[model samples]
Target: MTASHILLVDDDVELTELLADYLTTEGLEISVANSAEQALALLAPPARFDLAVFDIMMPGMSGLELLQQVRPSNPIPVIMLTGKGGDIDRILGLEMGADDYLSKPCNPRELLARIRAVLRRMQTPPSAPDTRVIQHWGLALQLAKRTLLFRDTPLELTSAEFNVITQFMQNPGVVLSKAKLTERVLHRELTAYDRAIDVHVSRVRQKLSKVLPEQELIKTVRGEGYLFIGEE
Candidate 1:
């Protein structure tokens, strides 16, 4: 199998180097950029990268800014590297289309796990020999293409949002606990107060609501989890 290429962007040269070395040892190909500008240049057309790890406190063009600019045209999965206590930055990064976030000075092992999780959510599965689309209650999921359409209108969703909605579509009315959702959608166990899954589900709901304004599609089961009210 081909190695997954990663773009690591941060102003901290030493950290990027250490991470590159560690990630390489862990079976992922790493590319380093010391600034958001350099990272943008590397993202130019025909230069492929499976995922990006951006530092939110970069010298110029913060990771949030980079995401705001890139999300309009590029759909690459991004994971933000944030300093502890920057809750605002983490939330804004997700709103701007980041796939995940990791606190700075994090264990290399944890970062590796987060990266693998994001890749699992972003990577499209192989086309089934028998079927490629799953449809229920006016929502059509093009599994092979990883796109969702409602009433023939396509929904613009980030990779993470698409994965969350796909899980909902697959289960229909099944009530999925937050822990179960986190494990299924993020490919990791849920941590205390970890709101990543909730944020992604909210984004999906917002997009779905915009297209289907008459009714609520994903309902929160207070104190339990989320339920997708769709026909099986």
Candidate 2:
């Protein structure tokens, strides 16, 4: 996959510039915005950025504020920057549709690693011989198109949701424990209070239910995590 373009939204000009410079050398296309207004301008051309790094404390608009506003319509991946009290903000960000978060004073190398990991998780699956479309109750999952068609209506899904559903669909009729789901989809090992997987699953269930109201497509495995029931 190609390198991802990142937009850095932070009032810390020095840190933002430095991080941009470092990440550029690390193979990511980096853009720095010293304010939320500037970041919005950059994002106006949506395709320009594959992901965003937002700082929690900024002058006019805080990271959380920006997340709330942008998340409703924007589909680009997001990662938040939190110095202290990151725990609470981390959960909020994920719930608001952020893909990940990194504590402040985080190693630049780790940041680079995370950016890469998120991009990798967003990749479209390769074409193969047995890559047939899966249809159930008038909803079709096109593996080749990387899209979901509900009642013959095509629906767009975020990369995170697609990744989670892909993982579940690949293991139909089998139970997926939360731990395994977290590893397969999140691209990182488990962290304390890591409710990222649960959030993704919830989002998927909401979408699936909306499309297939009669089909209980995703079932809770109780002690385990979830299962995707394939049409037999």
Which candidate comes out best when scored by TM-score?
A: 1
In angstroms, how far off is 96's CA in candidate 1?
Answer: 1.3
Tens digits of per-residue lDDT, candidate 1, 112-176, equal: 99999889867656655325688876788987777898888888888878879988988888899
Backbone clash pairs for candidate 1 read: none
For model 2, how does the per-residue alpha-carbon lDDT over 15-114 read when each residue is reduced to its tens digit?
Answer: 9888989998988888888888888878885356888999878899888998888876888898888875667787778778888788888788888877
Best by lDDT: 1
**Candidate 1: lDDT of 120?**
81
Off by over 4 Å in 1: 126-132
Estimate the Cα RMSD of every predicted model relative to the unseen true structure: 1.8, 2.7
**Model 1 Cα displacement at 141 (Å)?**
1.6
